[model samples]
Target chain A: MDDGISHNNNNNQILCPIKPIRCIVKLGGAAITCKNEIEKMNEESLEKVSSQLRQAMISGLSSVKICGMDWSKRPGNSEASPTVDDFSDQSLLDSDRFIVVHGAGSFGHFQASKSGVHKGGLNQPLVKAGFVATRISVTTLNLEIVRALAREGIPSIGMSPFSCGWLTCERNVASADVSMVAKAIDSGFVPVLHGDAVLDEAQDCTILSGDVIIRHLAAQLKPEYVVFLITVAAHDTTGGMVTKIWEAAMIAKLGIDVYIVKAATDDSLRALRGELKGNNVPEEWLGTVIRLLR
Target chain B: MDDGISHNNNNNQILCPIKPIRCIVKLGGAAITCKNEIEKMNEESLEKVSSQLRQAMISGLSSVKICGMDWSKRPGNSEASPTVDDFSDQSLLDSDRFIVVHGAGSFGHFQASKSGVHKGGLNQPLVKAGFVATRISVTTLNLEIVRALAREGIPSIGMSPFSCGWLTCERNVASADVSMVAKAIDSGFVPVLHGDAVLDEAQDCTILSGDVIIRHLAAQLKPEYVVFLITVAAHDTTGGMVTKIWEAAMIAKLGIDVYIVKAATDDSLRALRGELKGNNVPEEWLGTVIRLLR
Candidate 1:
């Protein structure tokens, strides 16, 4: 009745008994804004975040995956141009074996909304202006991010849901191959993904949230840990807290050991380090989720 | 006696004459701004000029060299950031055999004037500011130019007079090891040089012009032909046509043929058909100049 959730010696199919925890750290936009103030993004805070990530990777963590919302300030009406410093966050992101997925917030949301796509809570926009804008924004952002990562000597590959032929309707991604993700991980390369809308056979077109993608990946791969490096703490309500709470709830319900951590903060970031040091997550979740398979 | 110029006809002494002309076109800043009108740096006109150069090269006329100034709107300021498009002239300058040497007009001049390191004239207060500004600007400009060339699949090496230990005094290069320039050309690579003022052995520092460098080179190599593509025709202000210019004069005196030709005009550019046309200068003069062995 344990439903393969609990540890058993007979389930030798598991790669490692002391499953090396491979984590996917989701850094919420709210947390980024909270630590550095939403008014202006600070380089110091970014560096602090990068340093911590680097430490986590250097400590022999099986794998660390980082995801965040695209907080670039360029107006979405025109094509967004991310500066070289935009990817400065990679200083930490490149420290270990990690994959990154980002959300389109300031970069694509306004354009999508203006185009009358991703609006009305319905999926019927004939032209799909929102989708086209989102795709272009994501593509540009991905290129910049890839260049930054490469400059940092990290082998990173950009994978788009659209490129993979994943179809979606509204703001939801119906399906994806996911095999590409696995392949990138297997090849020691960091695969970068972003929250993007794609054509879906079942639902027309959908927006695939980074949070949802991480959950689906965890459910399948069952990584050792799932670290949510949001801009705010788990209980913060400044903005987007409702969505964070909902995501945390769903992840907890899935029975996957989850940690809602804040990036580069005095409190939560310290807690993140302590959690990794103490190895506090349940043994069952650790065994199934964390695998040190490199 | 023609004792100053040395010509060794031995085949081994010949430094790959038949080894495709890796000519580095050093376009003068005057050509970019036509001396009389800095505001008239026309892209369309320059484009035509570039087209003509390309045609000449394609017709087995050896390689064409171009200066970054040929594409710039203003003479480089020694104190500003170097723009990438400032070297757009290189688009046509590029080929399997071409080399380029660009000038730091505004970038270098601004620095020199501010620092009071006036290579041409003494302006104490201005020179003080110019020194620091020019140092920073030249480095910045050179880095940008190198990056731009690399982006276009042209590997360019930047050598600064200061870094190379070549100083200038009173508008003259005091001393320099010409080996660097020779090596770059001999190895089939593009060596980029710029107008710079260096600490001079005699006068403290001097302005070194690209034209002067080209003149010295003609004297050294005794190439079959020495062509100077200037903004204006070879005419003295006294209404006397100088069939023989300074560099051309020097080369001709050394018994080497020389040709001073203006860049193609708009009309000439339109009529260009990729033919190998000869400069109107007499054949005797042309033959005495070094020919592109390729």
Candidate 2:
């Protein structure tokens, strides 16, 4: 009669809670790749973003260490950057606990679309070939991004969905086990995930979009903020900016703020640093934000 | 005071049990790569092994589907292959439910040894660089193996220990959460794991050897048997054949038989097909088996 749902809830209640996740960052595939060129990475942009991430983590999380704050709950939007007084009081609640999810722009989209892999039919050899090709491409990028982050002293690990039982039903996410991601974060490592080709219940196999992954993580992890570092290209694959914005809006309904900023820009760093507001962006910062209205 | 160990036991009990694992196969790094050369894979050997795996699965496990056997426990060493009458009785207790774990071989040894990454000191930037280089080399090879297996219609998923919660303390495995591996197996995927560099509590980090991993998995999963597809070379940075045999001997103490066979050989295929025996090697069979002397 329980159907195991209540059993899982009972399981969760008894376990020690993980570090409160502060942000879920989405890196658009177009932002880090030469979209028109097949399998070409935008190295300069990637390096810039990595450096910014390092800076953001140091500035944001250092305060928590200095203050030795008990981060049980996420801070409200009203909270400002920590000051010396805040550190002394030890009430300042902020930490750079975030997960990075990236897209598979030029890395995988070509093979996926060409083979019609998104539709899924594993019996067909072409579809299977496409799945392998797509995974190789996307996982290559995931490892590259993880290596770049590691160079910046970030303990980043690549977690591929297909390798971790992430499944979809007719292009919709049917089941995604985020327990490993949660454990990775709890053990003091940044988890880097990517869009991947996964098995489907109905179609046999299909593409599991990174946008869908972000939304699912937001719902499950309840991060305080979600950041989208994207660059829209004229010719794009995998639904481009429209799908990202739509996903962002859906996540906003959960009362978490969402920032859409161009990658490698100061605006991206600003969003990461918790500076840019939903409706009050200055001319200098080029970005948009989504927030739920009370 | 409870250390939450009992709580995890309670959590596991409610979850659905996975299929009984018939085997845990180890593809030695030396067997799959040109150990003398840095970062080179032996493509021919890899292809042969992959094809053999496909054959073994089809031949050994196909009867289970036809007989519709309920596999609650692994078959004992005395049981032979299923027969026609066995199928009619619907009491065949054999299935090809197995997991693959490979080694780094020529892939990661050079970088890992060059930087002395086996002894960890994370503060040293050089150590971090070595970790990155080592991961790139090994993960590159892991992807190649996964792709090879995929080509053979084996649903292989590469699960890196570092990406999950596998940790070591002073080079001994302190904690390894095989929950993801179990989930992958339950969901009908052959989880492909590899020797990896992991975080160490005593040392800043250390290499978690494939030999150690095999022992841990055998102790935890209690598979019916284990097969080591290995090649003993003149030099091995990670203890070579001696360590493998010691690990196999240790596993044998748990009532699980282990076979040490030459990679890509007919004996290797026979070992996988459950044909080889301990201390009774035929002239054609080029392998050694370690079995507890009950």
DockQ of all models, two decimals each: 0.01, 0.11
lDDT of candidate 2 over A72-104, digit per residue (tens): 111242323223343233332222577999999
lDDT of 1 at B76: 44
Instruction: TM-score each candidate.
Output: 0.37, 0.74
User: Candidate 2: global Cα-lDDT?
Assistant: 0.71
Where does candidate 2 clash, by residue pair?
none
**lDDT leader:** 2
Error of 2 at A255 (Å): 3.3
Question: Which 10 consecutive residues of model 1 chain A have the lowest summed lDDT?
Answer: A4-13
Off by over 4 Å in 1: A1-21, A30-44, A60-97, A119-127, A143-155, A169-172, A233-239, A266-294, B1-294
Q: For candidate 2, lDDT tens digit of each residue in B114-150?
A: 6667989655544544565577667878887877776
